[model samples]
Target: MCTSSVCNHTPKPFALHKSSSVEEYLEKNKQWSQSITNETPNLFSDYNSKGQQPHTLFIGCGDSRYNESIFNVKPGEIFGLQTVGNNLNLNDETIISTLEFTVLVLGIEKIAIVGHTDCGAVNACFDDSVYETLPKNLKNYLKPVYENIKKIKDVHKDDIPPIDKKQLSLENVKEQAKKLLSVDFIKEKFENNTLQILPMIYNVENGLVETIDL
Candidate 1:
């Protein structure tokens, strides 16, 4: 029905459509894949023929904002393992297997444990309210990181002074790097200068990565 000037157009019946989020993602991915294929016809073929010879094992947080693009690395350049808080459990079979394969088989020479400023996981570790509200599995997963932070805080009880969440994020990166280096295989590689373990911090604000001494 039309009445006023604004209502001159006929009204269309409302119809339920597919989920916009899923549809949009699929559409965008389709277009992106097509564009890549058109721009570099042999990209995928080259990857298949050469296989993956990644030089770095980049362990970063699961946060979507942090990605391989941040390092300006092309596909197949880095084998990435993303976990919450960029945490790693050396005893976990999945992690151990991946590490072994990447180091021994793939011959990756560098392991970078990267954390970022204003990390939600780091904040949640110190915030009891948030920690209390997380799911049981997530809480268990993050428990080691929480305990590690607590230990760091305790060490700073004297004249060292307490640190904020950003500093804690850096400390978490260092702790995770230490854990990775403690593995016998990884330690052997390190002692022999076959492997390098780096603790890195990415500043989300400035898009700059700084290496931290472990």
Candidate 2:
């Protein structure tokens, strides 16, 4: 009988090796490319000739579990920008430039900030020991998110119960959504009903995506 709190199903033995070497991954990629080419010969050529006009800008966590397969988006359907914890720093040029290009140039009407449960980045914010071991650049990059989480914890300590990774993940998604709306262009577009920003949480356990009401 399975006794795990989260999962009730018994674990299965691995059919193939759990970890793959670089060459193994490359070989698998070759197989995938060939399979796709054989199944849809004109896919890439059609995308190339038509040019990309993705309707949504999806900002999500760098976690491999929060992938296109979960969102059900096909190739060239979404302009994706992934980062640690799905965080968006206003001063990040890459994020800013990507947003500008997607909205202003590509004319994407929707922006979704997606966070996932049990995020390492969100968990690290609660642990002082993790900060000490992280590289300086990464620590610096994630500082804002850590601070924001801390503020939320401090301010709502009375009303809110004990903070967990799931709650933090949802809050982070909402915070990132607010941050995006803070941009003048985004604010204007949102106010005029030309754009929509959604805060979403992806549950790795159940493979579910739920909207977080802000």
Model 2 lDDT per residue over 113-138, tens place: 88999888777765657755666775
Clashing pairs in 1: none
Tell me, what's the RMSD of every candidate? 8.0, 4.1
What's model 1's TM-score?
0.79
lDDT string for model 1 (1-214, tens) is 6667556465644232355577777777788778777977787788746888899999998887786668877677899998878878777888889899999899999998899988887887666677667677755666766666667655545634557777888888888888887889999999999999988999998999999998
**lDDT at residue 50 of model 1 (Cα atoms):** 82
What is the alpha-carbon lDDT of model 2 when measured against the actual structure? 0.80
Point out where model 1 deviates above 4 Å.
1-21, 34-41, 128-139, 159-161
Instruction: Return the clash pairs for model 2, or none.
Output: none
Candidate No. with top TM-score = 2
